[model samples]
Target chain A: MSERILSVLVEDKPGVLARVALTISRRGFNINSLSVGPTNIEGRSKMTIVTELESVEQVKKQLNKLVNVIKIVELDPDNTIESEVLLMKVSINKETQTSVIEKANLSGAKSVDVGQDYAVFELTGTSKELIKFEKLLKPYGIIEMIRGGRIAIQTKL
Target chain B: MTKEKLSGAELIVRTLEHLNVSTVFGVPGGAILPAYDPLYDSPIRHILARHEQGAGHMAEGYAQATGDVGVVIATSGPGATNLITSLNNALMDSTPLLAITGQVASDFIGNDAFQEAYTVGLTISATKHNYLITNAEEIPQVLLEAKHIATTGRPGPVLVDIPKDILNEKANWTEPKLEDLPGYKPTLEANPKMIQQAVELIKNAKKPILYVGGGIIHSKANKELFELSTKYNIPVVTTLMGRGAFPDGNELCIGMPGMHGNYTATTSIQKSDLLIALGVRFDDRVTANPKFFAQKAKVIHADIDPAEIGKVREPEVPIVGDAKSVINGLIEKLGDSEIDTNSWLNEIKDMKENYPLNYNQEEKGPLKVPYVLEELQKMSEEDSIVVSGVGQHQMWISLHWKFKSPNTWLNSGGLGTMGYALPAAIGAKAAFPDKQILALDGDGCFQMTCQELITASTENIPLKIVVFNNGNHGMVRQWQKIFYNHRFSASELTHHTPDYVALAEAMGATGLRMVEKSDVKRVFEEMFKTNDRPVLVDCVVDPDDMVFPMVKAGGSNDEVILNEDDLKNI
Candidate 1:
């Protein structure tokens, strides 16, 4: 079963998340990545849930049973432009500055320096791009990598 | 009518009335004097308990019986701390209870306040939710939210810590809307595919056993469980917490299976081809040796709590949803599967016939605990509610009594609270006034909260209490006798006990004492004859009498002592 992302909109309230998470969990769905944030609309929250589903029909049926869910949309990565933010601190010294800066610029990343020891870079792109960027920067002595687990949004109308 | 400026006490009385709370059980203190003043004039009746713990238990009993959130109030500091045990009791038992407590004052908070603690933080894990109201304006919403959280979703206790200053502050607050909580949600439906998979497994398996737990009662899925078990012809085994979910006398019943489970039930679980675990957590006590337990079967665990699944033993098909909804779905998908377990059923029957829950004292001992439980079982209706205090009496009641309905047996299952019986009985009686509510209490446990007889009388709730007066905590003493070389440390409770009959009379309730073994039956008969007030039956039983068919704690279920011979043989 390949992984699928489920974006659900629900009434923002106490116990609503517990209800939704419990429902999905009770259904035996192994949720991979879950991000909950307030939506653009007031008193509403959007929960982006990524889980491995045995079948699409099963996901739909399970999602339909949940109460207080205003809408649920299944996103397709093949056609939709999906992006996730990646934050990392790479050790930048005289020995590996060239390769690290080249990789960061290639990945459309901006470097923010705090001290002399290391430089923190913020990168936002597809999961594939982030992976590629991480591999390129590995030779430059990467200190820490924190990937804010995937949050997706459709690009086209 | 003159609308005078009301004190914090007045607002409390009015708020309680607005919430339609008819009774509040508590012990007043210096910190709560302000609130107590208005309680005198309020329509809500107040039941003063001997201890703060009793008050908390009374509230728990009320909630469990009525299916409404039970309300308990206490003073600051020690008063609030005393409620911890009962709060933990409610948490473990999944009883919906609302405990309101007074704090020292807002100004005094965090300054090593005399009677102030971070009650909200202290009770965070114990309570389903908690609030510390510093502002009087937030009182109405805090109360509303407390109730909503207490009674909703795997019901548990919720605490509202009111600062003394806030209670004293006057505010014109209307009933606030129960705002939507952002973080809390409870699931009510099962995944259809998992339900189908579970159904398919159930349909295909020849030797299927249904292991139900307390969640069935919590979710009110007893009817659904019964129907599914009956339709599929599956034998049922229950956890200690799951007692009373199915009629004990039912042919398909395999009895309670756990650390202290009967040999037949445990063996059946071991040999079954498919174990259908419904609403059970499969606690270590229930599945001592998980690898050996249900080893021959494909496990299907259905529970409302998501975290419970695979926490102990992994299931082949895990159904996470409300027990009622999932069971209903399973019933729907169970199409024309004439699954038969006749051979398996006969095996269980033979085991039961060979090794029954029996205590050999045919010669008539001074006290017969089993005989008392048997009489209570016979006299009460199938739906009559039974609550028990922790100890040998609890296990004895579990083994000997035949419960025909779910939620009828209320005890401190997970927590095993000793003083649980009297207060829980008070709560149960308050919840179901028309139903016969009985508390199978031990002498040690009964004395802990026996003072609630006053509350029982004052509230006019007819609660029946059967004290297995064995003069000790029978369970604790039994351990000392069996494993501790009979050293008899603090186990011997030889303190002066009150003249229970006289005590009951003092509390304005009826009490009967059975000194002679032959008079036990007559006393029970006479006790049941009265309906005007509550009754307490003080039957002096033998302290040496142990709840046999005992599996040593942390021992495998198969290693149970059925009789004295079994103990000697082992």
Candidate 2:
């Protein structure tokens, strides 16, 4: 199975999201990540879903059957701009502070919250860059971390 | 447009009248009493069902018979929850049905009020579309939309949940306008490129089978289907839902193909070179072990629902459109092109003659269900409607009855709900009061919803029902005998509780019992003679009789067991 992303536009109505999620899960497709937000239109919302599936054609056809769904388009990974945000809190001390600071600076991470022996950093980048940055901070002892799901828009409409 | 002040309940009745709904099936309760008040003065005929499930199935039966949107209503909590099975049945079969239910007052919702349930949440998956109407003003448009969504596109069930407060609230109503929905346009025209490609395949196919399904009847395309089949000389094999879509006696017709399908129809599909599948989903019952079904054949699949096009087995050419339009496109594209397949036709003819559906009746024993169906088939007119409950009796009717027109055969094919026949027969009789509507039910199936016989009698529907009483869930018993080494395991129902004839009499209908083989024809003749009131005939059949020409579930279609002799071989 390969990773697939779909951008769906649906009416902003009660239980619409439940309907979409139920339709997908009941069809036996495991969703890796999903993010929903309002669009420019007042009564319409956009959903970006990431899934690992054998084929996306069947999923598209099934989703199209929903009466609330306005349109669905697939985003090509090669032709799309994708990013995610990560919030992480790491423990540090005198010995490790220098190395952690150096790694954070190198990766353009911003220090958001600071404590006596711990520091919280916010990072934003492509999924590949975030993975590498995350690896660099693993030695510093991560206390907490939250990774936002991927959101994408086609570069060429 | 002049605005008329009306309550939400009155708006609903007016909207249904505007949609030309003359009859409805339902039950009344506290939450829905407001709507019933308006219904009391309306010209629409309402049949009070014994149960909410009965009402829902009756609507499904009406829709299946007339190709019209069937409407049903019920109250909150238990009444609404009871409609779940019927909604799922209509969803599975893609029947056009509308279910309206009353919810607790808007303020009382989510408080776990008495007789209140999350009707919309429970029915979301079972309906093609659904709405929870909390505002009184939303009634007119929402009802119109619900009917449109239920009747158009793929034709499935839709539900509308109206809060009690909304029904009682007054709203200013004007002539309603159907709002345009961007997401809900159904593709009615087939792609020309796909049609041309299908025609090319059809012209070259040596052994082609028209795999037809219920979409033909839903789209009213039987005439086009018949013309295409006879003109191209292609053999037609109908699925369970497609029983009456093609004339059974036609030379090109091979009969129903599925687990309990005819030997010729099932095998011909296995050996065909090309499948011109129209309005059919290759269901598991029909295409057991899809990997081995029609392995060498190229399928040209057409359906109104895009999701069904490549759902089971991938097709060479996929055309998403209504069946009638798709068939018309194919006919136009293949203008007078003749296909030569004399060898394949001869092979099919041989199979048909050698393996006709057969059952033996002992010189002195219980009546066979097939013999009973044959007698009914002979005694009934071509236009008579036959509805069946799910079991051995249903299979016997599908296998034996010679259906000559569309909408004459109705059954719960996908859901296999046992209690479907009696109530559905009531619905069909309501739709066509003058037509001969027969309900062929099994002993176990009859017991499930037999109480609906009172609804038929009270409404004076004049439906003729036959219960094939083998005293067991015959299909389950057949499976146990074949696969489980005859461990009966609670399938028996013959020990007798309430006698069927007595129950029929208590329900205010005429009752008759047929036990001897010689009484089958005469009993059916007598049943048909009584046209003024509902009649129920209890036919005591042999418990050991089984439905054959069967492909073991999920088995290859090529491995069909034609009879008990074949079973012995297995």
Candidate 3:
């Protein structure tokens, strides 16, 4: 299956997210990732969902049936602005600490905290950049990793 | 409008009154007691159902019969959960039903308090739209919105779950502004370009069929459908849900199409050159195998919901709009461009004559379900409402009964929920007190929601219920007989205890049992004559009797099994 990103505008109400997610996942579409945030429009929230779907058109039509969903737009990876925040703690010793710090600096990661054997770095970038940076940290023995799901917006409209 | 302090329960009752909801079917419980208190003093009459499921189905029945929004109320937890079946039934059928359920106290909602359940979470997927009301002030707006959503475009069940505390809390009552829901606007008018395309297809098609669905009844477009069918001399085949949408007695009407559908209707649809599908989702029951369904037909599908337009089979011309408006669009565009289809009509007439829906009733043997239905149809008024339970009896009624008007036939079409007939009949009777409401049920189906008979008896709602007691799940047994080498495993009712006649008497309804074939007409006549109270006639029919004109599940619609000869050939 191919991954498709959908930006849905819905009413900012309790259980509205559940309704949308349930409507999608119930139809057997696996949700790869989803992020929700408040929109500039009052009483409305925007949800960026990354799903592995055979036909996103069918899902859009189903989503449109929900009373809370105001709008749905597919985001083209080529013309869409997508980003997420990643917080990673990497294991480091005296010998590898310098190299790890240098690599993290090159990847635009800020050292949020430093311990004797561990370094906590925070980064914000496109999912592609984050994946690349994650690979860099993997060599340093990642202690833990957490990334906010991707949020996208169509750049043109 | 003057603002007045009102409790959430009061607000609900007042809003219902404001919306012209004269009747509600429900059973009160702990959480919903406050609403009942207000209801006791309101103009809206509440019919107390024995169970919440019965209430929901009754509401659905009322909606289907009258083309009006039906309301059902129940308390939280078990009460709300029980309504799930009915909610799903309404959802599948596109019935305009509003289910108002009481929730646990707002403070104890997540605590899993006594008799508390996550009603909204449970019903979110089942309902068209649902609201959980915790704030007293939100009651007016949410209720109004719930009603609007349930009754408007692509009508379906909408639920409003009110917390007990919210129901008790006081709030100022004023007519809240109906929010403009940008997400929920249904396309009601057909695109002009698409209408022109449909017209062109109609002009070119030699063999065309108006494949009608329940949407016609929901949209009150029976007149439009009739006009179009007659004006074009096109034959019509209605789905189970579209039973009475077109008069069954009309020459152009070729009965139902699908599994257990008429031979002529099924074959005609399979062989048609063009199908002008209106308000119908080519359901699997209608088009057994989508790939092979209407192999020759170029489909022009019209429906209010965009999702259903291409959910099954992609049409050559998909028109997303209300059935009535779409038909009007087609009529406006056609503008006296009628070509001749006499040859096609003659072919259909030959098909109808050669393959008519029939059943054998031996004079010396036990009564048959079809015979009972035939007699009932003959004895009942033309405007009488016929509701059936699922299985053998349902198929028999759909095939045998000659429906002459829209909204006169009601059953659990989509979900095929058994035990739907009695309560739905009660609901229909309540809505149209002047019309005769008949509940035709199978022995297996009748027992599921038979408890609702008490509600009908107590509420003084008279209904004529005919239980086709064949001593088994007739449809299942038929399948076993055909597919499983006659191995009737758990299909037969062991002993068939609780004697339906005695049970009927215990429930305060007149009980009658007919075992002989000759007594079919007399028993029906006697039952119809007694109209003061609910009457339950247990018809003892041959258990081996099966519904014919059967298209084996997942089989092609063209391969209909007409009788023993057809089965032997297969």
Candidate 4:
């Protein structure tokens, strides 16, 4: 089944998240990535939630029942600008530095900094792009990796 | 007169002020920014909590302590969700609280809008009433209704969910004056025939017992209860919530009756021929086993909630009304019945003598909780209030502490909430600044909401906290030791606890630790002498100690586990 992304706008207040999460839980919906942040409006905030559901229509109907929900939009990935960031630190010797730099540059990555025994690379792109970059760099000993979950914003009309 | 439009957020503040809510505990978030902006300049004081869950507990503590409605505000989504535990806590304890949360804008109601939640539906079962306001104009009426529902008729928590758009939108607002609401009427009068029948049963019964619950204090019927108990010479048994309903040292007072109840109290309840249960629901913890509780007795149950009248064991005479009013009626009907219970009182006195709360300890061992409680009772005035969190310490306080007046012992009885003591102590201190307030807390319970010590310090409320640092969930551990064959699974909690003295000093308060039993008196003396800042006495207790005379759930009240020797006699 294809993954669904839902954008929900709500008033900022305490206990609202609990109410929504509990509602979704009670409805047996498993949320994938739920991100909430303040909106441009002073008193409003928005939540971008992604979930795998049986039917998009059923999810839409359930979203409508939320008391604090002001708007709900099911986004199509093709029309939306979605990006995720990956911060990976890898161990590299002086001999392999040239090859690693070449590979990193090929993936549109930047060498952010170098530690005593490791070098950190910053990568920002779609989830698929980040995964592909990780696969190419797997030969180089990767020590630690931190990935920011997907955050999406719709493109202008 | 000319009027101006106000946002729903502004309306909520005005309504709260109209309802006489001077203080609220909450955390600000995106969904509730509008309300915070208005609140920034308002007369109401909002305490910002570190977590949304903390806000809920703080409100619960405040309400439980003051007997006034506690109010908590949180923004949409997670903020609202975090309050579930607190709401459930209030619901179980029957504490009156008003929880307000901001929701997503109305226009985005169903379109998968950000932070949108169906809070009202989620909270319906936990709250007495819940409202989701789509219109800004309805804020005033909704708040008033919430307060009214919360304070009247078996007081409990209520929730008000307002959409962000509604809060930001301009609307004409007016405070509603009438206290009455349509289709909402609470019973205040007792059933006359039932009251008469109860009086008759009380007068003729050879062994009669008066079982009181939190309802007596809620109804402010202590004087009436005392008068009736004294007039009829009937002994009284109180539930944990009803600890201070009767004078502690009263001759006819048996003790608290329930799961961890005193053996004398439970025995008195079992032996009574007539049970005049007033303002009590006979909760499972109190009754133990419904079928066998007060087995030989005919029950005359009087309560404000009609549903609770026959919810457990059917009452022979059920009077549905305010406890104070029904009790008053009972007193009026029994004008000088001159009912003597010297023999019954003697029997109770014998039971108390035989099964008194006793714990074995060396003279120089760690401080005993009961000793600290006894000292606190001796130090404070008769009207001083004692608040406690749920655990072994709470039961210890209920069993040992002496209360001279009603509503003097506030506890999270039904809810059994840990981390309730410190906040509750602050609330009680705030409610009655001049009166002494003490919090009896266990180590496990105290750490849960110890952050409230910051509130106590900042607010400068001189509340005393006596921490029974047993270093484990004592009650649960005790149960495992007894009933579970000492498997000790998750009950064993061994962690490096914070240095309470350093914690108190850091929080700008006085802290004392009593490791040796001999030092208890001196430490208590210092605590009682200090009047400037709140004091924390970390009294290290015996880890192996257990709260005895506990009746297992589903067991008869008579089936209590006393010290081995006492069990042999029984």
- lDDT digits (tens) for residues B273-358 of candidate 2: 99999989999999988988998899999999999988998999999999999999999999989988788999999998898888
Global lDDT of each candidate: 0.79, 0.91, 0.91, 0.81
- Across residues B1-570, which tens digit of lDDT does each residue of candidate 1 receive? 534455555666766787788978888886677888888877787777778899998888777666677889998888988998999888887888888899888888889778776676566556766777767766777787778778776788988888888778887656557786654567779999999999889878888899998888778888888898888788899888889788888888877877667778877887789988888888777787666567788999888766577767778998878889988999898877788777877887898888777765455666668877786678776788889998788888888888787777888887788888888888777667788888889888888777778878887888788888877877788888878878788877652367777788899888888865678778888888988999988787877887777766666665777766677655
Residue A121 error for model 1, in Å?
18
Which digits, one per residue and each the tens of the lDDT, describe model 3 over residues B62-175? Answer: 999888999999999999999999999999999999999999899998998998999999999999999998789988888888989999999999999999999999999988
Q: How does residue B277 of candidate 3 score in lDDT?
A: 97
Identify the superior model by lDDT, candidate 1 or candidate 2: 2
Per-residue C-alpha lDDT of model 4 across residues A13-121, encoded as one tens digit per residue: 5555665676577567777777777889876777878787554445554454343566678887778887788998888888887788778878989899976667889
TM-scores for every predicted model: 0.78, 0.98, 0.97, 0.76
Q: What is the lDDT of residue B346 in candidate 4?
A: 90
Clashes of each: 18, 0, 0, 44
DockQ of 2: 0.79
Fnat of all models, as shown: 0.00, 0.63, 0.83, 0.00
**Docking outcome class, model 1:** incorrect
Candidate 2, residues A1-157, lDDT tens digits: the string is 2888899999999999999888987898778778888999999998988877665788889899999999998988788888788898999998887778778878989988777788889998877888888889998899998888777889986
Instruction: Give, for candidate 2 chain A, the lowest lDDT window spanning 10 residues.
Output: A50-59
Better of 1 and 2 by DockQ: 2
Error of 2 at B197 (Å): 0.5
Which residue segments of model 2 deviate by more than 4 Å?
A92-98
Model 3 interface Cα RMSD in Å: 0.8
Tens-digit lDDT track of model 1 for A1-157 = 3878777888775556765665566567777777788889998888887777554445554454343566778887665666688888988777667667777877799887634667789999867799998888887778899877677776655
Cα displacement (angstroms), candidate 2, residue B192, comes to 0.5
